[model samples]
Target: LPSQVSDAYEKILSRSKDQSWTRIILQIILAATRPLTLDEANVALALAIRKNEPESHSKLKLELWLGKNFKSTVMNLCGLFVSVYDSKLSFIHQTAREFLTDSEPEGTWKGSFNMAQSHHPLLQSCIFYLSFPDIDVFHPPFDLIDDIDGRIKSYGSTEYPFLVYAAKNWPLHFVSQNAADANAFRIQARTLCSATGHQRDVWAPYYFEEYPNSTFDDWKVWPDLTLASYLGLYEAVEDILSKEKPNVNLATEIGRTPLASAITQGHESVVKLLLDNGANMKEQENDGRPPLSLAVWIGQEAVVEVLLKEGANIDAQDRYGWTALSLAARSGQEAAVELLLNNGADIEAKDRFGMTPLSLAACSGQEAVVKLLLKKGADIEAQDFEGQTPLSLAAGYGKWANLWTMLRGFVAIVKLLLEEGAAMETQDHSGQTPLSLATEKGHTAIIELLLNKGKESKLSLSQSISA
Candidate 1:
C-alpha cells in the first residue's frame, strides 16, 4: 500500500513530461479509489504539475484539482506550487484562500512575511525580498506597511534590490540559498562604494542615523573618526561634530579617551588631528590614570613624548597616587622614565602608599630605572610610610640584582648618608634595618656592600645597634 501510494503519485506526475494529462487524471482517480484521502490525491496532482511537465494545460489541471477541496491543505499546496513556478497570482490567491478558510476572521494572508519578520532584520529583509513581490503584501496592516517602509529607507541605494526582494517574498528573503547570494551582493556593493568613494549620500545617511549622538570625546566614535581621519576626510568628522559633541571628558566605556583610542590603535593621523582639535592629553582613565601613564604603561615611548610635548602633566597621579614616572620606572621603561624626569617629573614622588618611584623601580628589579633614578638625584635613603628605604624595599623583596645595581651606581649615597651622620642601624616599622633586610633577603653582594660600611664605622654592636 505504501509503494502503490507513493509510486502512484510519481507515476502520475511522470506522465506530465510526456503530455499524458488524460492518463494522469485516470491514475489520480484510481489512486483515490484505492482509499487515499482527497488531500493525498491533490498532493499527487500538485507534485505532477511541479515537475514542469510539458503539459499544455498544466495550470488548468492544477486549478481543477485545487477546486475539489479548497481547504487549508489544498491552499497550502497551491501556495508552494505557485512559488516554485513564480506564479504570483496563484501564490497570493491560495494564501488568501487559506486566510479566509481559517476560523479566525482576523487572519490575513501572510505566507512568507510572517516568517521573515520573526528573524533578524537583515535575514528578514533578505527573505521578504526573495519570496514576495514587494512590501504591499500586508496592505490592511497600515502599521506593518509603515514599519517596512522605515526599514527599507534605512538601507543604502546599493541595497535597493535586496530590499525589494525582501519586501516581496518573505520565504525567498529568508531562504538560505537566496539570502546568502543577496548578502554577497550587498557586501560587494558596499565594498565598491568604499573603494571608489561613490554614493557618499547613501553611506552618509546610515552613518549619521546610527551615530547621531556620537562625539569626538566619545571613545566609541573614535574608531569611525579614526577611519575618516585616516582617509583625510576631516569634513566628515566635522559634520558629525557639528551635530553634537560627545562628552569631551567622557572616558571610553572601556576606559580610554578618543585620543587614547586613536593613539593605541596606531591611528597617527587621527591622533594628530585630535590633538590639533584640543583633545585632552591629561584625561585619565582606568582608575584615574592619565594618557601619558597609559603610553608609558604600554611602552609607547613615542606617544609619551607626544603627550609631554603637548603639555601633558607628567606628575599626574592615578587612584593609587602613582605618577607616570613611577609606572614607567616600575615597568622597566628607562627611556620613558628619563623623558618624564627630564620634563620635570619628580623622581622621588611617592604614591598614595608612600612608595617613591625609586623604591618601586627597585622593588620591580628594574636595574636601569633604578640607575636612572639614582643618577637623577633620587634620594637613595628616602623611606616609605613603612620606614622602608629604596635599598630596604629591594632587599626585603629579594631583588638582589636591583640592590646590587642601586648600590653600585649610588655607592656614594651610602657613604654620603654615613658621612652626613645617617643612621645605618635605624630599623623600619618592621624592626628591620637596611642591613637586616639585605641579610633576610640573602643579598650577599648588598650585604657585603653594607657590612664594609658597618665595619668602617667601627661602632660596636651596642653603638651600631642603638643607632
Candidate 2:
C-alpha cells in the first residue's frame, strides 16, 4: 500500500493503544482485506465484542474498510448487510447493486432509481461504474438503455440511444459525433428528417451526394440529397444536381419543397442552382405559400433577387392575401421591400384583413419601406378598413429607429396629408388620436416630430391653455 494507507492504519492503531496488541493486529488485518464478505463481517463483529471495543469505533473501522473495497466486496455480498447497516452503508450497497445490475460493457448505465431524498422522488441516474481511473463513465461512446422491466439492454433498437444522464444529452451527442462519420452522418440526417418531417435544412448536406445522375426521387437517393441540403453542402448539392436529374420539385409531407427550404434558410447558391435546374419558382406548397414569400419572410435578399430574376410572380399572394412585399415589410426586410416595389408590385395592396402593405410596414416600424412606398405615390392618407392610417400604425409600435427613418421624409408627407384635407384628428374605431397613440407607446421623438409638423393645429390648444 502507499504511505498514506500505512499512515492511516498506524493512526487507527494508535487510537486503540489501551487494547491488547494481538486484538489490534487482528482488527487491522480484517480491515485490510480486499472484500468484506458476510463471513468476514461476522468475524469482525465477534472480534470487536471480544475486545470490548466501542460499537461506534467498530462501525467506523468497518466503514473505512468498505469505502476502500466496496466495489469488489459489495457485489459478492448479495445486498446482505445493507438493511442491517447504517444509512450511509445502505446507500453504498444500493448504488453498488444498481451498477452491477444496470451497467453495460461500456461501463455506463442510463436508468432511474427510487430514493427518499431525490427531488423527482424517483430519479433517473446514469452511473459510470468502472475499475479503470482513465475511463470516464460519464460520457460513454454508447448509452445503455434499461428496459421498462428494469433489465439492462444493449443499444440494438431502431430508435437512437439516449444518455438520459450524460452531461451533453443525446441529440447534441448524436449531432457532434456523427457530423464527421459518413455512414453515421447519413443515418442521423435521415433520422432527423423523419422526425421533423424534413422541414429543417440542417440535415441537407448529409443527404445529398456529390455525383451526377443521383436522382433524389429514389428513397435511398433522396436521403442523400436531404442530408446534403440540410447540412449546407453547397458543392454536394451542385454535384448531385449535375449528375442525377433529381426531382427538384419534390415536396415533403408538410409541403416544404427543396427550393423553399433552401431559400428560407438563405442558402443562396443552392437556391440559384435549384432555380436554374428547373425548380418550380412558383411552386405553392400545400399551405398555398410560394417560395418567394418564404425568401421575403426570412429576409434573404440575395435569394429574393435570384427568385425575381427567374421570373417569379412579384404579385403572388398567399392564402392570407399577403404578397411578398407585405411579408418583407412585416419582417423588416427593407431591401426586399424595395426590390418587390421596384419590380412593379402594387404598393397599396391590401391583405385579407384589408391592411395595406404600407400599414404593415408602419406597424413593424419599417421606416425605409414607408418612405419608399410614399415616394412611389402610395396614398399617405389611405386607411385600413378600421380607419387606421400608416402614421397611426407607426405610432402604435413605438420603434424609435423606424420612427427616425420615417421622420427624414415625414414632414412632407404630413403636409401633403394636411393639404389633401386628410383628417389630422382622425381616430381608429378605438377613439384614440395619433398623438395619444404615440404618447402611449412612449414615442417621445415621434411625438415631438409630429408636434413640430402639426404646430398650426395645436396653436388653438396652446392659446386656450395660456388663457
Predictions in order: lDDT: 0.51, 0.51
1-467: candidate 2 lDDT, tens digit per residue: 23453344334433442334223223222222123333333333333334232243234334334433533343233223133233122323333334323333211111221121111100111011001122222211213211211221122111112111121121222222222332323333233433234322222221221221332223233444544554444545666678666787877665667787677667777787777888888788787888888888877888888888888888899999999988987766777877888898888889887788877876765666766776677777778877788777665554454455355444333434444444557798888877777777676665676776588668967999999
What shift in Å separates residue 397 of candidate 2 from its native position after superposition?
Answer: 3.6
What C-alpha lDDT does candidate 2 achieve relative to the native structure? Answer: 0.51
C-alpha displacement of 387 in model 2, angstroms? Answer: 1.4
> Compared with the true structure, what per-residue lDDT tens digits does model 1 show for residues 85-108?
221112223333233233333312
List runs of model 1 lying over 4 Å from the truth. 1-223, 226-250, 266-268, 399-423, 456-467
Q: List per-candidate RMSD values in Å.
A: 21.1, 19.5
- lDDT (Cα, 0-100) at 423 in candidate 2: 55
